[model samples]
Target: MANSKEPRVLAIILGGGKGTRLYPLTKERSKPAVPFGGKYRIVDIPISNCINSGYRKIYLLTQFNSASLHHHITSSYNFDHFSKGFVEILAAEQTLEHSGWFEGTADAVRKNMVHFRSQNPTHYIILSGDQLYRMDLKAFMDSHIASGADITIATTAVNERDATGFGIMKIDNKQAITEFIEKPSVDVLKSGNWKIPANARGDLPAEKEYLASMGIYIFNAKTMEEMLDNEFTDFGKEIIPRAIKNKKVNSYIFDGYWEDIGTIRSFYNSTLDLTLDHPPFNFYDADAPIYTHMRNLPPPKVNGAPHIENSLLTEGCMIINAKSITKSVIGVRTIIREGSELDGVITMGADFYENEEAKADNKKEGRPNIGIGKNCKIAKAIIDKDAAIGDNCSINVSGKVYPDGENKLDNGVSFYSSEGIIVIRKGAVIPSGTVI
Candidate 1:
């Protein structure tokens, strides 16, 4: 069990990236604010991990399209006035000393140092907002203190194929990082020179592979202050490499499921995995539950016998006589009419429910309601929120791979196709009998 004592830690969650790879889903919201797992946003993962680990003082730094992110944070996390715990949002602002926006991750923290210093914490925990995983950060901080290291980074072992995409580290016998290389080439990894020492891994299965950085770091407050005095922009690209040469940097091995959610395909696969028989990351862990903003909606309604196999249906959904749904995630307040067959799809439920009058008005305006109509077949796609698909529509029919393409209209809905995954943007309307 992790230590239960009050921790003197200030957690900074980097939330500024404009997730271009996520495209239409991130069109209006920041990456961290993007919806995930039917009921939560991507930022909930890290925030919940922090709360679960007993670290309450959190600072979320965001810049692009931060209104939704700000609203989510303000509405979701509320601490008592009598307690010192609070989750605050520190947007990039102009001051007399600095005028530019955050250039990189390190710069984001550097620009917010004044706010961070106000807490007067002994340690600083830096985290990314777009990854999915569960961890007891108290254990991570305890390891750093036990090792007496200036900085400790969370790392995980990666196979050869996945190793090239991460910042590889070479640790000595003492489990201290000796060298750091960010996104090294296949040739560099094949040289057999950057292998981590087997004994240094501490009970983990020894393999002739690299330790990839999880982008979770703990820094002694004073050490972080001194390191940020310079103009290093990124931690992986510059700060960690420099710190390895001068400071005692140790690696805390984390052997668990962690996905960076960097691209659409990766996001699609990881989310659908939740409906599997035995998922890699389970959200039902009562001991460490993923927290999110609660909604007071009625339970899902199934009008007739709908064949649902290995699917997750969230709250406020109405499935009306669907033929079959396999390996899919139906978000909150989603409605599927009669004879609709969906497979391997993620339907992000509507933001607001439309009443009978609204549906009649939509019909008069030749628009479908804010949900799926009758006789639609959707497969291997992502239907964003407030989308209206008319009757007899087929999506991703051919299963073609489109790396990047979109049909976007001015003041209208947009459709993006990536890696054969069709993304119907929020509020998109697909007419009846349409096939794609």
Candidate 2:
């Protein structure tokens, strides 16, 4: 079953930069650690994909706000003594040679080359931590080896509007990428030969004319070392374009449910899409299941027969007499109290349940307990972990307009509004009858 000539591959996941675009979600934890699909973190997708693809030796590189991410990874992944596989994080550090934070994706990997070299991998599979997709990376590596490429980029056919936001690759009939342009303008796209060749189109849709980089790359170890030998900070902007000139670069086209959870709008839309009857991305596939920390949470409890429809309620939730819950994702250990209505909402849920003492303390402070309170109506919003929403409050109510960006309530509690959705900050407490 083993091809002795096949190169040993190691996976590298780039935990993104400050993630300013994601805003309050990335305020405390790194972007990869941000929770997704009610139960899993963003990092879990790529890590699970790697595990399913038989690549277990992985490294995640991050610099800012990594404490929660570290905790999540350590708690989730553990291999047996017989296996030489491990998932580790390589945070940016100050050494004699490098004293600054990871300037960009390429720089981040370059700084950790000393550590990765110790593992003696023959090639590297670079992935983004915040994307949602299931890929057979073993097959991807096989394609790379068969093509005898120094660098292989995973690309997906996207429409013209979406193509401008990504690095467009121009490939020949052999799937060999001949040119690379980073975020080309519309004029350049119309004027330049940026279209994929007809022979290579295969099953790609006719309207999807351009091939956009998916930020997934497989690199020969020597070629990667050579490419990172400079001060080039980024791969798309510098490293990739330069490598295209001198290296045998190829493209692997992927046509699947791939979503870059880069911005609030994209993240919101992607999460809600999971509530569909047949989601584009299936998490229930037993052959390639997504893995996360096993909290051993008990099944959710619904009392008084709340009306529920097309929602994802994770483990350890108590739904008590809710008026209705529609098209939402309720996270672990969440509590939806009596007479509350939630629609198109994503609640990250509480870390730990509030005992009697905690409830008493909350009562003394005139704040609601850590969950949605009675008779509240929340819609098109994200309730972060351990947030307390008091009774009879209105959030993102129908026909009620609210300004976007960071806004504070009269009680000094902070919440964020982006793309017309309200985001209750983690550990925030909204007092009784506060309307927004």
Candidate 3:
């Protein structure tokens, strides 16, 4: 482990992706800000992970629909004024070097080398902005220095069936990565499996399963700066794999549970997983609490019947009347009407002041004025802000919201809502009594 005299660790969160998979939700804001776990966005998971890991110096790289994300960061996180370490959101501005948005994950980091230089960090940790995990990164950094390696990529034990879809690794006795394969075939190690044998590296410690890259990385300052100079744009595609053959790239096998909510089905499943009897991700741990950009809102007020079960209700939520809620995640300022039904769904209140640009363009403009309508039947759905649902609107009741349209998501899992779903966009209003 590296010495702990407060080593300078700079974390760059890649938040520029247009998550089309979680559409309607991502339509108005960037992927990270797309609401998750009821009151949080997928981005919060990573930000909180950083917070939990004792990393205070952080930079968020964003581009498409970055306004809301920027706003949320400012409102939720305010440590910048008093701490030696700070957390900030840096949007990719158009300069002579590049005129458009970030090209890819590596490009995002490459463009922000100026930020790293300004921070004068000794280590650079690049992370997927939309992943879910809780890690003690301080330990990961210590190991990086201990191995005397140029770069260290985080790895986790996974079923090959699950590992094959991710970057697989073969590490040596000293934890140095021996070989690399991206999204290998199921037959690479075992049929119906996707993990690389831990013993393949021979030096790896005992574990329950094979190790796979988690897309999290730590690089020696000089090594990362030099690698960023090339044409490599995507980390997994060009950076890590290519660096394995040249630089001393190693792996830190992580045993904790980690999940990437990239696709709609995967994203949906991650949220539902929080309801598990023993959730893989525990947010209640005071010793290791997930830090995130806070929403600066008042805690919720359940005015009417307060029947919440296996649900995550955030601050500023108003439940006018409800018999009981089972398996639901409700966002801030979200209001549920009288006699309404909600099951396995995410809901939020919309504010018009935030989307002035879109509102001016007359895009789904009706949603900003009102809240979700009274007595709307919702199930397995994701409802965005300022969206109003009419009375008695029954969304995907069976969780299959889209029966006709071709879902272009990687999962091709059709509609994200298995019990049926409906997205009201930023400002669209669902007419009263309309059944979607």
Candidate 4:
């Protein structure tokens, strides 16, 4: 049951960025390695898409806190030897010929050209790591082969407010890209540097005036090798613009839920979106499920008839008489004590359980055990892994629209308030009777 006509495609996931926008979260791990949807990492989206699309030979390019990422990939993805399917990570390394870190996205790919070339793929599928969306990549590759394009860029129609944040594309009736602008300003759009005819706009509403690049691309193997020969540092800022003029570049329009998790606000909002009754993006699609490192944990336990609504409670959570929880994502190994309340929160639960001896030691040292404590009220917050909140704590940010500032409380606890969403850093300890 295979499509013999389909080209042998190699998927390359770029996971090397520093993730400066998602700081604090990305402080200890790479952006792709950061947890999402309670139990999955950010890198799982692209990798799962590749596997579901019948493309098994995958390569992940990563740097900067890649140890956890490596562990997750190796432990999660292991194929049978006869299938010749594999998922591998290629970190930035120094060789006799080259001795520097990956300078940019294009550079990261260029440096790892030798490894990719060894796979002998007909076409290359390039994807970003920090985006959340589910797409059938086989259809994208089929469109690329049908178009006979040297390079095909995946595009989505966006309204005026979002046009400036993306690489806008101007395509002819034949789907050939005429011009490409990276993050064009409002004045440029008004000047009519690039325009789309009404007939060629497809299913996009008339209000959505521009086609924005999704940062996903399919390149013919030979064409990519030649393009990488040049001294381009980045794809969006450098290579793609030049390629539009010289090469047979086309566009594949994708009309689906896609969000580039680039900033804290975007990441926060997108993660919280999953708690909606009918989310734009969902993880429950059995036909194409997102895969991650599975843990052998017990089911979540809810005792004392706690009020819960419109929330995702992951495995190994113990909720004992919590007052209420609404619109939140509770991660693995979470423990919510009596009289606690959570609203619009994301608790990234503990990495490990604290045994009785550990709890005793914590009490002796005047520190709270891991997880939330009793009589606490948390609203619009993100509690990172292994955090300990003492009893009678309040982390509500009701009136603030933006962060007034961050503070480092006693016992090495760091608290950051941004866009009125409080973030308690990983392994932080908040003593009793604290309020924010």
Candidate 5:
């Protein structure tokens, strides 16, 4: 077997399409570029994992709303001139051969084969840019090489409730995956044939009968080239299933904290969970810290230290005599005025500080300044960057209050609510005495 350290590995992070499920958040930026946690972008999870696992040469394939993603990547990850390790963005473009955007995950990589050929890597690691997980890629690569297989998939055991959303698989005693089904129906799972035999279950929970694909894969360079030579557009939907019948495919079972932030509900819930005493996914790990753009803003300032419990406040925030803040993630350059109370909120904070002139202009133009206005009550909502909420406005009103689906509100930038979570659009201005 070849030494895991000796092989050259290239990491490819798949920037997802339109991201309609994460609507307003993906309205202006790509899913990966959306602000995550208090400060980092969603893309940082996979990129950080790659770096921590000692795989530095990485490429991110982007298609929709890539401008902000480009800026973020160029600004955040800067390698030295002497090192070949770099993070770059390969956007979809029309060439002489193909004149279209990335149709799916596999097609995205296939289209960028010209660039991949130059790197000449021994193995390729494919990852999802928008998921939240910290994996040791070196270990995963080692498992792939040790399995003596051309392609290896990283899978996690999930319960029946979550099984229908993922590609479920059945593996043999040798850890070789023999059967694959994408989003199998309830009746299909009830057949009891897809469940892994008890002897082959390994250390996974007994309740998690199905192994769901985590959308993470490792492919031998030659095998990837050969697989992409065809017209298959998706790995999970096409390439992978076909490869299982012809190639020796293996599964690397991962029992770790992984959350796919696909919708506004998932994003909001996962983010707020960080404020827990012990979060499922830890961002405070010193050995493998999550990295992001270093804005170098000053430390957060609390005026009177008004009630703050189970919250994360990032740099450059001014909490001025707030009544209380609980179970929230406040972003950079946030200015919470006096008498404002927030619970279960995730504010992306402002991009740039509004100067005295900007504030004067806002006042003159009959607008509130950038941030939460005074005496406002916000609950179960996401306040986007540069959102101006005027004083005495009640947002979302109650924790249980949510629209059946999506309800559009008109005021400043016309805010909206999805799955009961109110989202104030970026740069939106809610006038005084406004209520939603």
Candidate 6:
């Protein structure tokens, strides 16, 4: 067996972001801290992936609107304190050495490089804190080493129509990337030449062939330093663009479910995906499990609600007297009042106000009492914490719901519950029998 002399590998999680796109949810916490899959936070996915991948030395970089994210990381994740391996979180702080808010993805890493080098790992595996996917990074690293590539990127085939926001790549007979374009123009969508015989699809970009980057990367420690020092901070917009010229940049094709939950609609849809019979993600894989700081909460209690289908209910949640909740994710301690009906909605942890000290100033400030309207219906909508809706409110206001509120009315993204989700705003309440 190989001795344990291998240089420690570092998985640096990029958790710092204003996450303005996910505003109301991100207003209090960072993107990753946004509650997900009923019980887990968005950050939990990548952190869990790292632990399951056998790389215990991890660093989470977070900043801006991060109080909740920071608190979650500290209280929940406690690796073996006595063991050599551990996971940790780092936030932006001011010091003479270097201090400013994280500007971009690459800039975030550049700001934290000092802390990273201290780990002195043989390889650096960087991940976006807000994507949802599962893979064995160790195997990806082995492939990187075997191919003798300076940098390895994770890629997946996406529909050509949906390739607008993603970085597109063109490969050749070998898995080596030949040409790369960052969010190519529609007119520039040429048939990509990148092809690997071992792949399920050899012909590059055939009819619907656009290979998109997953923004996951493995870098030789030295290679990363040089890349960071060269110019810009973003790997997608800068580093990889520069490396494609001379460095050996390769791609690994992953044919699995992957979603970028950077926006509200996407976030809401992604969370809903977990409720499918065969969910796109499976946390049950013991061998490559996603690890997180566990919460000590009792099991959920579903009282009098019809048998749930295509929904995820977390610990300590009580569903009392609700006739039905179809295709939704409910967070801990959330209560669905009797006679209320829900469909394709997400009620996150702390979603209700419940007239606590926090809401003491509510009435004076016009904050509505926290409770859902009785005998009302919510479909394909998101109701934020603390703002109680009147008994007869309508969420879809209009017939159609679109991101950024396509109707351009105040209803706010009728379908988006991610960043900028309809905020009940702490302490605000809707009068009974009213409609919003």
Top-lDDT structure, candidate number: 2
| Residue 7, candidate 6: C-alpha displacement in angstroms | 4.4
Give the RMSD in angstroms, all C-alphas superposed, for model 1. Answer: 2.5
lDDT of 1 by residue, 308-380 (tens): 9999999999999989889999999999999999999999898889989999999899888888989899999
lDDT for model 2: 0.93
Q: Model 3: number of clashes? A: 25
lDDT of 3 at 194: 37
Clash pairs detected, candidate 2? none
Residue-level lDDT for 250 in candidate 2: 97
Residue by residue across 38-100, what tens digits does model 5's lDDT show? 899999999999999988999999999999999999999998886679999999999998999
Model 3 CA deviation exceeding 4 Å by range: 1-6, 80-82, 190-208, 292-298, 303-307, 351-369, 398-401, 404-421
Superposing every Cα of model 2 onto the true structure, what RMSD results? 1.1
Residue-level lDDT tens digits of model 2 in 1-436: 7788767889999999999989899999999999999999999999999999999999999999999999999999999877788899999999999899999999999999999999999999999999999999999999999999999999999988988899999999999999998888988998998998999999889999999999999999999999999899999889999999999999999988899998888899899999999999899999999999999999999997458999999999989999999999999999999999999999999899999998999899898998999999999999899999999999989566667779986778778999798899999889889987
Best by TM-score: 2
Q: Per-residue lDDT of 180-255 in model 6, one digit per residue for the tens?
A: 8888767677444332334546444555567789999999898888888854868888889898896999988777
TM-score against native, each model: 0.95, 0.98, 0.84, 0.96, 0.96, 0.86
Candidate 6: regions farther than 4 A off: 1-7, 191-208, 284-286, 351-373, 390-393, 397-428
Ranking by lDDT: 2, 5, 4, 1, 6, 3
Worst 10 residues of 1 by lDDT: 405-414
TM-score of 4: 0.96
Better of 3 and 6 by lDDT: 6
Better of 1 and 3 by TM-score: 1
